[model samples]
Target: MKRLLCLAVAAASIPVSAEDRTLEHVLVSVPIHRQESNSVLPVTVITSEELQRSVATTIGETLENRAGLANSSFGPGVGRPVIRGQQGPRAITLQNNTSSADVSSFSPDHAVTVEPLLAKSIEVLRGPSTLLYGGGAIGGIVNVIDNRIPRERIEGIEGAAEYRYDYAPDLNSGVGVLEAGFGNLAFHLSGTSRSTSDLRIPGRAIDEAALAEQEEMMGHDEEHEGEDHEGEEHGEEEINNSKGKIANTDTDTDVITAGFSFHFDEKGSYAGFAVNNLNNKYGIPPGAHEHGHEEEHGEHEGEEHEGEDHEEEEHEGEEHEGEDHEGEEEEEEIVRIDMDQTRYDAMVHLYEPMDSIEVVRGFLTYTDYEHKELEGSEVGTRFKRDTWETRLEVVHNALLGTEGVVGLQAKSDTFEAVGEEGFIPKTDSTELGLFLIEDFHRNEWTYEAGLRGEYVERDPSTNAASNEDFTNWSASLSALWQFDDNWQTGVSLARSARAPSTEELFSNVDAMDPEELVTHAATGIIEVGDPDLDNETSLNADLALQWHSANSWAELSVFYNQFNDYIFLRNSGEEVDETAVYDYLQEDAKFYGVEFESSFHLTDLGPGALALDLRGDAIRGDFKDNGDVPRLPPVRVGARLSWTGDAFGTWVSVLNAGDQDRPGDFETDTDGYTRLDLGADYRFSFAQERELLVFIKWKNITDEEIRLSTSFLRNYAPEAGQSVAAGIRFSF
Candidate 1:
């Protein structure tokens, strides 16, 4: 396979850009693996330079602008990527094709382990080829590619370090990395740290009266009992203030990775092993409070009550009563939430080409992740999981005038929740699957088809009482046609399925009360009947077109996805009459949308080249009377203008969100607003091998009080207002 790829490379006569030359000539290059012939799949590639140029804090935030992607944020510190509107366990996150081993499925507060700053490139595989991954990848796959281990035998060492700071939004961040190679051995390591204070709006903060009006228009009362009462009082006073500061919104992260590879020159193959450990300590947003109501009566009340009691028990010194009162006040329960997480992952990869036929590749990985949350009165749920995966594939050549590929994979996972009482029962899951892919191409037309057969088993350890086993199949077909060097069109149809995770099955604990009115409920209070949950299946179809001309690029896509037995947590109005009570249930759902994006370069400018980019998405979907999947984002459109030159680059973008009427049983409609972001960078050469990038960014330029549909705190806490940030990056 390596020789074939080499031959193809040598035979090609395409002009290579300077960036491409640097990657292929200076850095070790690996064969660009192509999906088997006749398979209809689409993969989007994001270069490292793109990541560097984006003013994003997390991997999910960086990709949110991409087509067909969305992000759910837990304040500014955490975010999860959503592909085609599907998230959680259904979307697999990979670091070099291995699971990230994080608790992303359990909640939105947890951060992914992959460091966006350290990544070399990001690959998003859509369509059928996702079956090559585990069954969890029903949505798609996000692979964070990095050069931690040597891809080829080398003889020396190389490393780079960077530091960045942004002042407008009050942010400071830095990273350090090192890599070394000796003969066939290599290693890489990196660390990053960041901190930010309250983010300010771009202009004058929204007037308190305006906020009240907006809330009222959205069917939300400004003075609901135990709901934003303080804001209401402040509004009554005619005081205009900035949005609440993002408390504990700082972050400290560290990562260490190392690997060793052995080059087999005779066999034209390389075998390697790698391990990564990530530790992060970040702030969780503050929960909303009901007015200025103190949890306690007051010091005067306690003293007065103590005095009365002392009079009654004059013989029993008052000192004892005073001490008791103080203790009681100090011990009053006040919810203070915080989170800590750690992940460890190890993987092994082997590549070898057979003397005849095709090349064979094998991969095995083991991952362990632990997450813990601390909150007053809450059960403080903790989850730990261990997963093992192995895959073997055989790439076939066109011996019979047809090219194709076949693969087999098996995965086992153990998920356990300790200290959750009886709410979340420990679970063990195992899955096995076999897949085949065939790719065929003739002139300007390409076609592909693939299918996968899978078996899954789930068991509850606490009570040998509940267990389940099921078999499922997934398939997809796609076709792409190129009309010219600058135009291409494609269509795809696929069937996908997702099994339930432990959290969806038995999570029975009070996670947290973001809104003060909602008290905690027993985990899985709604209950799970029969333990025999069927798989959620979906049929999806999409049509896409791409046009790339000399200085311009554009893409448009339309898609529809229908699901059978879509699993959702429904607001069971009964809820023991409990506020914010929701039950897990299954129902049918359908989602359809169209997205368009385009970019045009205005080269006839002054000192720098100018470009305009526009993108938008409109989606409408419904779930069986479940009140329109709560937290589904609203239709949004955005446009950006950028200028790049030898020493300076800058970009400004405006985003607008449409109103959302979809509501959960206990949910309310959300108003929409517009925001603006502007950023600029200046480059300077410091030395022969060092450079610097000084940048500044302003977000929410209009100071619009925008509310994101994907936010859990939308009821009481609004999204952050506009703010400015400036930073410098020094590289060596």
Candidate 2:
């Protein structure tokens, strides 16, 4: 702890120049846009400039290295945010304050449909946003802001385009975007495409079974089909994967968005509408296929038969008998995730500074999402989700000596699944909520509080499933005291409640054998659900410190959370249908974590400015059984030396993670490794009011073999190895 304080003190020594001032980040997830320094919640904002500097494949990976954040990486196409050691339904992803409305939270293998390539800004709000968002946000919220909803009218026309590529995975990507306006009307259009081959790793950390599972699903027996497993050592055959390639981990994606807006004569008033369509198809790093995995588990309930789909579709009369032709034949039957989503959003802003209110805002969105798990060209587990949401807020600049916002939010969604591997049952979920938030200040001191009440219902298609009508309430209070011009400290307390998700209440997959366990297609763990589960209520506390100026800044945040009736999966210590049996259960749990971030301007070396950046985060969680939480990220610390000039920028950083020894039940320890990254960028203006920026970055420069504690596939697939990425982008 003393060492952490010393680091903060050192970071506080940076000097600030008035010429290149850093804009303090701000938060807009709330009804009103406010500076981070004024918000009670711990917020991390990543500007568009920062996004352009990093080579990120998924939205979750883009912010995974940030303080108090982790990524649940499933191959290269899937990355869900894990904040403060909480994930899944506990945390939520949003697109401009609306839920992403994807099935990413349903399982780790499912990818999020939102594209980060065209994002204008991103925000991570730590702690509960139960009032503003919903019970789905017991952990936090990640909001990606895009230009789909035009906010201003251009004089003529303007646009930007970017093309990017990487060597390690042979990735190619590009994006085109434009905006035009006539009088009070404006329009926006954008398109993005990305494709990549199999991912590359440093070593063969992958297991042999993972590589051979695809062929096994294709109805080929190694001993009889001539692909003999001759030198099996202790049941672990190293499949020559040392070639440094993680097969079936490739991806292809395309996205298009259009929007229009009409501005009124009154300032701060506008109405806009947008539509976005996303299509993505990505491989699921071989191995998790089971029984040809049909989409409907109930089709053959209580049956011991698995993988009968190959009964007639054996190679489709393709080539056979030859060794080379057979090898290509088996590799062709890899599994992939095919997904698409379309969303429409309409929003309005009105400015009428009356005696009681300052402004009124409304936003509505509709989303249709679907994804199919393909096992050798046949749909395995098909999932679909449709959602509609709307919110209205009234903001008051001063109400009884306090600034306040009152809002009402409603949402409804239907989720359905079919196919052999379908785990969760069909269900309809709806919510209605009301919230009131206020902020008060007095001479360098600030106090904020919020209250929320919500009603949620979960109805399943099966009459045997549980139906719930839950009423939940949440409250939070915070006090910030600025002791000096450059130093400030604050504490926040919150009590939030989250209702059970659909999967936790109605998942009842028909295992291959009623007496044995069956592995889940997504998690590779057999799972069951309980219809009697209850809502989880949490008491959270946070303490934070900040000291900042124009060129230097330091921050430290610590948090603790305790929950009652926490819904979690528990191993039954038994086998069903030849797979491990895990059932949903309720228990008491506790989670705690600390995060530190600091930046110091070292010295102005020649014509450029030099700075030192240091950051670290760690967390631990346990249930009443004293068992560690599953897939928790390990402790990490890193530092970077950066330089900035008139038209050039460069940075070098080293990130290190500690070994994770506190493994969950039935889990093994994960070794740690260090990674180095170097990046540089240059900007050139070829025309008036137009500039092109080019950048190159080398990630994992040492080519270290690494596994993340937060990944479900840590044992079967390691993180990407050393890769060189370069890109060019232009704007006018």
Candidate 3:
């Protein structure tokens, strides 16, 4: 690694073209097809080149380093993006302008199905996009766009292939894309394969101090250690304490997609369809589900000791009878998940479908998804969801000096979960929404406004709880002013409402006996949902200022939100079967934050050009009566410096996260960390505009023991240690 780094730096003398770091003039599809800089909303777009430089197994991990974002990772297999201080249902994830229709929002351990490596670009829209996507996006929206169903004609055949390997996780990944066009017909194909071994860490997997404190609170001591010894003597297997690496953290995934498009007229009218299939299998960390078992064993320790000798004799007599059975059981005991999904999407676009209508668009999609959690060889739980969604939009001609689009969306879902840990009952849900947005330009100021209304209904399989219905409304307005050539300012305000999700309303535990109450193994807690929950509403405001030049630009934004009837799972300060009890509850809350980003490019720096980028963000959340919110990300600041020549470029970055001290009710404080990384890339241009790019990256160069405050498994699993990753991409 050292030699490679030296060679990359020493190659600066080679004559090459200076790399152009200018922002592309691409339109962000998620926000009404407007350029990010000109829109009233705060948007961040990651182009294809930037995505290739840094892509990970999960979308959250891939975008975690971006300003105002964090990864709520579950071991090395699962990661979901947490925006500002909100996650789950509040922050929506979309693929090509529609919901991915995955169960990631149901639990932190579930993975989002959208693959970042296969995307053409990614758009992150901050603040309320509720008026367009849904009320669920009261926090933000992340849309991954791909050209699987191309709307434009391609000249001929073109493709790209890449292979990457990482040291810490022993990961191997390969991706390929191929596209062809003939006349007015176009076709696309893409696939990716990835696999990994257990993750390497800086030290022990378990935080001994935190574990000891937890055990003490559970009234446990060394006296309970004999329980595990007895189990081992009786031929039962035990999970050993992991050192230097996190056990059961391996993963394997595969994805394939095929699409076709046909253009009907010369005026840019087209129809397209695409199909995608994905399969993944991954393991959960060892300590995630062991806490409840330890607490239960501690509670029974005294009783077991009284009959220790009698039990020993009984066990000795039956040892031979159960040995074979125990061995068979041992083969299947590691906790893992196997999931698959198949999705079909179709869209239609028409130019001048009617008078005063510039365009008419329609989109439809259906998804079939299922997953099973396995304990050893036995299925512990199974989750399945079938979703159908459709949307229609009309882009009308300017009316009264204003341009706008009106849209209608409808969706239906059938979801089921069965097994030991199926806390929420099966349910059917439906939603219908109508929305309209318009923009007006006048002199140096541009103003935009939108409004949306939705109706939602839910029906469960059980009669213990009746069906529920809700009606919600959302609206937003913003103004942008370009008072000078190099300066701009924007202000936005929004009021959004979201109906409660199925899991929040239908997680049933009242029917089960106290001793047999169902528990969510991933979280190791007993959760009870409220059937009478009301819609959550939010009032938000934002202010931003930006300055730009030919090679330099800077932007700063501040935002505040006040929520009514904010929904959260709260610790009830109670226990059942030695497990803590948590209830879905509502409270008024407030969140405020600031984010800033700046980049400067310079010339005449030792045979090459240099660029500097700086970023920082901070947020605070509190309840009107309670203390702080739980699992909020810490304040972070980072900087990167890069040197670019005609053919070779290298960069170095340093990021520091402040300690998280206000870990709301029943949570633990987390220490801060500083991480350093280095990377380099060299391009080789060939004939026919074809090119090959080789890149190398060194992550966590210092091997810091970093624990993310946004993760529930932080105390049991640390992030990966020092590692090197290298890859080569061939584009034609």
The candidate that achieves the highest lDDT relative to the unseen native structure: 3
Backbone clash count, each prediction separately: 23, 18, 5
Rank the models by lDDT, top first: 3, 2, 1
Clashing pairs in 3: 16-646, 17-646, 332-376, 332-377, 333-376
Question: What is the per-residue lDDT of model 2 for residues 1-732, given as tens digits with 9 covering 90 to 100?
Answer: 333333321111111222322675556686654677777678877777777766377877887888888888778878888888788888899998889999887777788776778888788899888989989999999998987878666678999999999987788999999999899998999999999987888866354343244345323354245533233321221122324776777889999999999988557578999999999998876433422221110111111112222211221232222122124434445668899999999988777746677778888999999998776667867889999999899998976779989999999999987877777778999999999998898898888899999999998887566578789999999899998988999999999999888877777733335643334555445667777788889999999998887778878998999999888766554545434455777888888878887787888998998988878877777877747776777778888888888899888888888788775644556777888888888999876689899999888899998888787667567888999999999998
Q: Candidates' lDDT values, in order?
A: 0.57, 0.75, 0.77
Each model's TM-score, in the order given? 0.79, 0.88, 0.89
Q: For candidate 3, write residues 1-732 as lDDT tens digits.
A: 121122111111111121322544465344355477778787877778777777888888887877677788888998888887788888889888788999988877778999988998888888878888887788888988898898788879999999999999999999999999999999999999999988989877766575544444434455354475454554443434466788788999999999999998888889999999999998887656544211110011111111222223222332221121144433443678899999999988898877888888888999999999888777878989999999888888878998888999899999887887787788999999999999898999989899999999998988778989999999989999999998999999999999988888887634555665677765556667889999999999999998887777777888999999988776565667556666678889898888877777766588677987777777788888778776777777777888877679899888888788766644457889989999999999999979998999999999999988788777778899999999999999
Instruction: TM-score for candidate 3, please give it.
Output: 0.89
Best by TM-score: 3
lDDT by residue for model 1 over 675-721, one digit each (tens)?
Answer: 77888889888665567777777766776776556554453235557
lDDT of 3 at 505: 88
How do the candidates rank by TM-score, highest first? 3, 2, 1
